[model samples]
Target: MCILFATRSHPNYELILISNRDEFFERDTHNTCWHTNSSILSPYDMARNQKTSPTNSETFGTWIGINKNGRVANILNLRPADTPPNKSSKGKVSRGMIPFTFLNTDSRKDSFSEWDSFEKFEHQYPCLTTSGDFNFFYGDIKSKSYRIIDTFGQTFKVLDQNDNDSFVLSNNTFNIENTKKWNKTEEGMQKLKELISKTKNESNNNIILMECFKLASICSVPEEIRNKPYHVDPAITYDTIFVPPLGSNDGEDIGLTITKGDFYGTRSQIVILVSKNSKHVTYVEKVLHTSDRDCKTHSAINPKDFHQFEFEIE
Candidate 1:
């Protein structure tokens, strides 16, 4: 998963996300783009080859999706210390699949129903390994809402609607406890807007957004265990920006702008725009120049395998 941009307040703030997954199974594969319908379960199946992992019987490990309902979710591999296995051999279900699956379902109430349901399901079909932790967040676009469910130790918190207008999801380490005080939705949004306006003159709005994500990406972990790969392997090291169309409406540009880089790597920009609202994307524009040396390294996953792809919110 590359980068995710979303907001609960502006339905027009349609999500703009891009992913470049490295797969050892397919050598010549390219980055593939997909459009998920109201239901995310189907897309999750198509995105992952369930047969590859032994835990497929319970859950397929993958960054499932973010829905237009302002619901953004992703599963991350937990650290070993964060999740110690039980001696009982009943097996554990893959917690990473919870966020993707929750957004796929139609449950509307945010009263821990989603988390409870996931827990019940995992009790039946356990996962293969129980070493890592599972982290998930759900946000409602209309209400400026957000909820973080750190299910390893019953850690759950909801962000107040008045404190934030938009929230970014990244593959970084962050302290769940410190974020509890971040329920000031309105203030957070205002600050974000100010930051964006101040940086908009930098020639690229996408770069400005990347800066916000980097700041929000701050994570907390024990210094001794920080070096250890606790969560998802090859954690998302790059950032991408999802720009809503120039105007605020649906069926608009559906164009997505993306930037890939880290604090040290070269950054390259790519723009995917939909010319026609047909079943598939028609126009894809990318910046000719790149600031990075490895900009030409194609992803192992083919971006064309998925079809009827467009980044617009219904």
Candidate 2:
């Protein structure tokens, strides 16, 4: 499972996100743009590759991605539904390609029309759900297009234009309730920071970043769930601080504070400080991971199988 948090304003984009993968895969890539791995055939890839139905197969899936054209796509796994079997299933589409395809094929101006096309395409292919499933949220800032597509459970919801705010989508559930409780933007940010801190560890840089992104993407916590204390065993916390670039051309600096099990791990959190006046990243802290015993095995949990939070960033 993966979570993405980002804020897009005109030409500038800020993103803090994380991706959680199942334990089987032991690789990570930091490519800026989206592309498919021809050698790695996931269920979605297989469907797309074979032009067959997605009944029972492992497929590629993505958390979030932003295209060079300023298009954005986020996907979450969802629960499979009980539909009548049909022989007319069209070729399936891979989830991994959604972000890249959305960004590459259509511009912001044509988002609405493009969404329609995607829906039609998926409906025909009809991916099957094992235990894993997913839903998608897509938007094109230039075109002012936004949509929510559920592949496994429930119907698609079209977000109102007024609903535009910093929104966070998480696994298993959507956190819309938290958005209503915070009276001030700072309060919300603090809450988000706190949430991310709970999931931090020192072992893997990607794992730590993924937890931070999950918190950053949150829009608000529901009142009912807000007061609830952490229940997951061995709760973790990590810190990520962003330092803006020094000069006009630099990117920005980021510092991470790592902690776990009510104790600071031997290795301090990594920090990535960007210099001012640089168009790209200036410096990155050393990568770290949780201890083997504390490190949880990564796995892909279907979007329908998890919860999500949608909030506004001030």
Candidate 3:
């Protein structure tokens, strides 16, 4: 239950990632911070863990994160669309570990341009594949190109200068090359392109982030559908950027054990902008809903309410 829009087409910025993290409000999460014993910047999912050691002092995994080296990784989960799968969390891997592994490790000191760079990295940490399907984009942001692994982890592609001006992903979209994607995904991509074109000659970064937040908050999910039972599938339930709170009834047919009145929706919105020089970065996250504060309806968004950070590349 997530949506991301990214652009490498902008002249002033090397890469821009606009993301929405949608999940159940009941899940406990920590705000973004500099990871312990590492240069990675990411938030922790207190509910999921990898049990790396007996003490498990290692920080829990994450959904989106970046390293001081300018490497970034963001993940979106995929569900069994047509059929219900085993709902047991036993022996299952947490998807947050995928990004946690990537962001914590260092890239090749030589160059990430090497073809074997990602392959060796992926093999170095086998957590690349998780319990369920996922779609992820990761690479050194300075490169202005991202490698994507699709839902089934079968298709792999790189977004470069010659490709589309922007790329968008949701729980939908089997592959980046695939023609079919959620209309909401298409809308985000189009809006990103427009934003890039409009800000081509502009120098202000705030303008860029404002537009990114606006794009992240746009939605295609109808009010009627949102008011209904929530599912992870694009066609079944989640097909929008800003997901409003939807109730879950512990649907057994769908393998969801959520009890009555447990709501699922977008919990946070993130925007990361890496300047063309690649040394400067702007990161912002706006918390919308949580287990304590459940915003059933969308309200006016303000940037001042967001958690903001700026970091220089190491």
Candidate 3: 10-residue stretch with minimal lDDT = 252-261
lDDT of 2 by residue, 71-99 (tens): 55666543111222231112134455554
The residue ranges of model 3 lying beyond 4 angstroms of the native Cα positions read 80-91, 108-121, 143-145, 173-179, 223-238, 251-261, 296-305
Ranking by TM-score: 3, 1, 2
Where does the lowest 10-residue lDDT sum fall in candidate 2?
249-258
Off by over 4 Å in 2: 6-62, 79-94, 108-111, 116-132, 153-164, 173-314
lDDT (Cα atoms) of all candidates against the true structure: 0.33, 0.32, 0.68
lDDT tens digits, residue span 212-300, model 1: 43333323322353322223222122211211101112211111111122111111122221112212222121221122222233211
Of 1 and 2, the candidate ahead on TM-score is 1
What is candidate 3's lDDT per residue for 1-314, written digit by digit as tens?
A: 68778777788988888888877767778878787665988777887666877776645777898999888988776643433455332226766777777676565564555422445545666655444456667777666546766435454555567775467876654453445556567676778788888889976888888888888877676657654555545353445667766665564332222322367767788899988888998998887766624554433273213688899987
Rate residue 35 of model 3 by lDDT: 71
Tell me model 1's lDDT, rounded to 2 decimals: 0.33
Query: Where's the lowest-lDDT run of ten residues in candidate 1?
Result: 251-260
Return the TM-score for each candidate structure: 0.42, 0.41, 0.84
TM-score for candidate 1, please give it: 0.42
